[model samples]
Target: MTETPQRPLRVLAAMSGGVDSAVAAARAAEAGHDVTGVHLALSANPQSFRTGARGCCTIEDSRDARRAADVIGIPFYVWDLADRFREDVVEDFIAEYEAGRTPNPCLRCNEKIKFAALLDKALALGFDAVCTGHYAKVVVGEDGNRELHRASDMAKDQSYVLGVLDEKQLAHALFPLGDTVTTKDEIRAEAERRGLAVARKPDSHDICFIADGDTQGFLAGRLGKAEGDIVDESGTRLGTHEGAYGFTIGQRKGLRIGTPAPDGKPRYVLDISPVTNTVTVGPAAALDVVGLTAIKPRWCGTAPTGPGTYTAQLRAHGGETEATAEPVDGELRVTFTEPVRGVAPGQAIVLYDGTRVVGSATIATTTRATAGAL
Candidate 1:
């Protein structure tokens, strides 16, 4: 008979009432580990919390998690981390906009909440590791190095979203659903076959913490609106906009501009200015970029001691590109192989080599990074 992964004594499975997490908890228990199901209360209002819950965390979701725990015969609890969630994830998201940059709150949440805060709590409670439903593979290499690889099921690969994780975090983490279950569709079918109640729950979309994908509305609700000028590359005042924070690089709609492009083309957001409340708009070609600057660099493993050539990804699930990376102060200067378009501040760029993650950073700025040597 085949053996299961040696469960490290006890595990804290992060349950969000989804079929993936439910199966993860079950797999952990089946592997012969002491497992406890914990739901992270990341929303300000648990009773109304539906971001993570929206995937399945409704009252029905909590009940489904509880029910799954019961079926798996494990202990379950809810951790109220709303304040930290707001500060670390939600507030950070807003601050990125205020600074005229985009931010990946979900990536930040994984860094701050899932791996850091919750992992610390689990260790304090004597748990050996934390488990989740992310679709990525973690492997201890021949040299005893840990690296995250794309899932066996490419369509469900979440390594892009999880690109921010370092070796230390991946070490104490378990993606029980990565290879065992190839797809969410497969997992849901398994749950139903097992007679689990959360079998047919709809998948969550948009930013889980935000209600729907009304990012502009949410930002306006919190930071209030400021009028700004929409300009072209020649510094021509094409139109006015609501605020700089309401737009992102590569956005092609919702400008509400009175006039169309001079070349009979569509306009795209090129730049944002919080100080002047000004947003720059131009032809779609203006948004195409070659290189970028990144901040808060993190190497998946221990970062190389000096400059190194590496593969980099600008966005989650985006294709990989060739680049040379060097750590400068807290930021990284990455020169890409080609001119990359839609390079935006606040999004994360994760570096990799083969299957191993090299480093990652929040893109604070991009001036077409293709000029530097690779």
Candidate 2:
């Protein structure tokens, strides 16, 4: 864990009504800091109860957060950020899909809502720092700079999603749970010992806004139906689909194509073209990506001046791959040492120097490896 200040500071804990956040807030308060708990009301109309933890921002979650704050003896309040969340996260998600790309809403929420909007508001209120339950560390470097690093428990490390944080944001962030090299079950036990009611609460999963976990249905409702052709690499029509936006790169299960490949192998979605209103399908080999160009890079500390070798994580729950990355123009250009599969546009590509996060960017394009390269 990063060394806590000897002097007690004012901390605004963002309690997300989970066991993790509740415990995090408790630890902050116990550290002699003046702590206040606040839960974000992300949805305008929150559901009564979550469907087995498939979603969050429900009415029950707010109540659970309030109870946890009470148990911790901290002042609690609800912040209505529904409008900001809808505009920044929900709308951005729809727009990305409509543009034939896949976006990670969790990253957007961390960047825009949690760190940007929430931190700005906290600073205006004279708060010293914003504390959360994210499983990532903020280490004060020898040069007096704050660096973002992965958690001790690699299984629960959330550094990939938090790569969007810049140097300014890192200076005012606190993560109390990052250094604990214990299993999640032990954390729950700690919460129980602390009398936090959320000790047994299930962790939220999937896209929170889409409660049913039916992403295709959600997109269909917003984008409506625009029937398009599902074609092959050679532009040969293999089948048809209701909407091209519904498919993502490397998706294999729902292609619904009646025609099989020449080798009778299952086909996967290779590309989506919104301009042509087409969804291209081919064998899985075509999904191998050798290089990618990403836009709007955000560095945790200092930006890299030249090309460097680092491990790149393409998705939130994905494994890292060795890559050489450099800043070119205003974008990040990365070439993987070995081809990686299922890399999609609009997704975040986070670079790390071992356990420390280097930066992150939104993937705009990908270069596929040669045929049979994989």
Candidate 3:
């Protein structure tokens, strides 16, 4: 069977000053698309340089992006969306933590900044699609519906983060790095072959806005210091903390608790109540959660009408577990086949059917497996 030839499109390629994005733009241009490279100025006061690859959105990164666009032989421009990014991603992150929830800012950025704001602006500018180097695929079905799927490289697969995209956003999305099953080294090699300079550039890690990767310090600065009590499951005061927002569920270290567990076992953060300004620590077994309730669901295609078997991913780099999920009363309720540990509210719960993305929602609450449930 002969495949239909793809018509050239007016593509807006998002260049992140990294090898992956540079090569993605190059490939899009090579495919006969009218590609224009763009870098989003997501920081209000961009740093002069990055501290290794620990963060991004620096002045140095913008310059690197310009150089990559020059090598790709495409028109390049930087769009200032720093205000939107601060409001949508950064502030939302702070607020989530203040409410005693663990939020994934990357997923929120993809949903709000890249796909929504960027795609909307691109469409207004007559661009047919917004292309990126994300390690995920946008598969078009026989009925002409676009479906988000995992990339060929499972190790670098990023479909979980892209699960928040709805059908409209997926329609105008292009992921040039998704179809290849190459390793990170191979991608760097390809970038070198193409004369792109970021081939050896270190991949960005940790939270981008948190330059030093000290999330506790960052939150403390923003939320201010409020002395709180650290207690065990039995309501016995173990120690004191500067703030309740400094800890997360399943956290095992930096507890600074003066007292040790009665059974001499390592304790983990079991609960955080901002209202009471209390941080609760207990055994790891008490962290097991059997079910969850999620809100603000976003689907890639049609919403599921009935309960269905799916694999749920609780974290960006975490493993998936078998679950039965259904959408009821504008909320997603999921029951895991087995108890899972360290489940947290405010984190996104992405559902997948095989390699295809089902949808995503912000986890609002969880049902604990043990009798000592909070």
Per-residue lDDT, model 1, residue 368, is 41
Q: How well does candidate 3 score on lDDT at residue 133? A: 86
Q: Kindly report which residue stretches of model 3 are placed more than 4 angstroms away from their true locations once superposed.
A: 1-5, 48-50
Q: Deviation in angstroms for 201 in model 1?
A: 0.9
Better of 1 and 3 by lDDT: 3
Cand. 2 TM to true fold: 0.97
Candidate with more favorable, higher TM-score: 1 or 2? 2
Q: Per TM-score, what order, best first?
A: 3, 2, 1
Candidate 1, residues 60-176, lDDT tens digits: the string is 567778887787788999788889888998898999898988887778888899888999999888888898888877887776777787677867777777877888787778887
Q: Which is superior by lDDT, 1 or 2?
A: 2
lDDT of each: 0.77, 0.90, 0.90
Quality of model 3 by C-alpha lDDT: 0.90
Pairing residues by index, what is the TM-score of model 1?
A: 0.92
List candidate 1 stretches off by more than 4 Å. Answer: 1-8, 51-53, 56-58, 369-374
Model 3, range 209-303, lDDT digits (tens) per residue? Answer: 88778899899999999999999888999999999999999999999887778899999999999999999989989999999999999998999
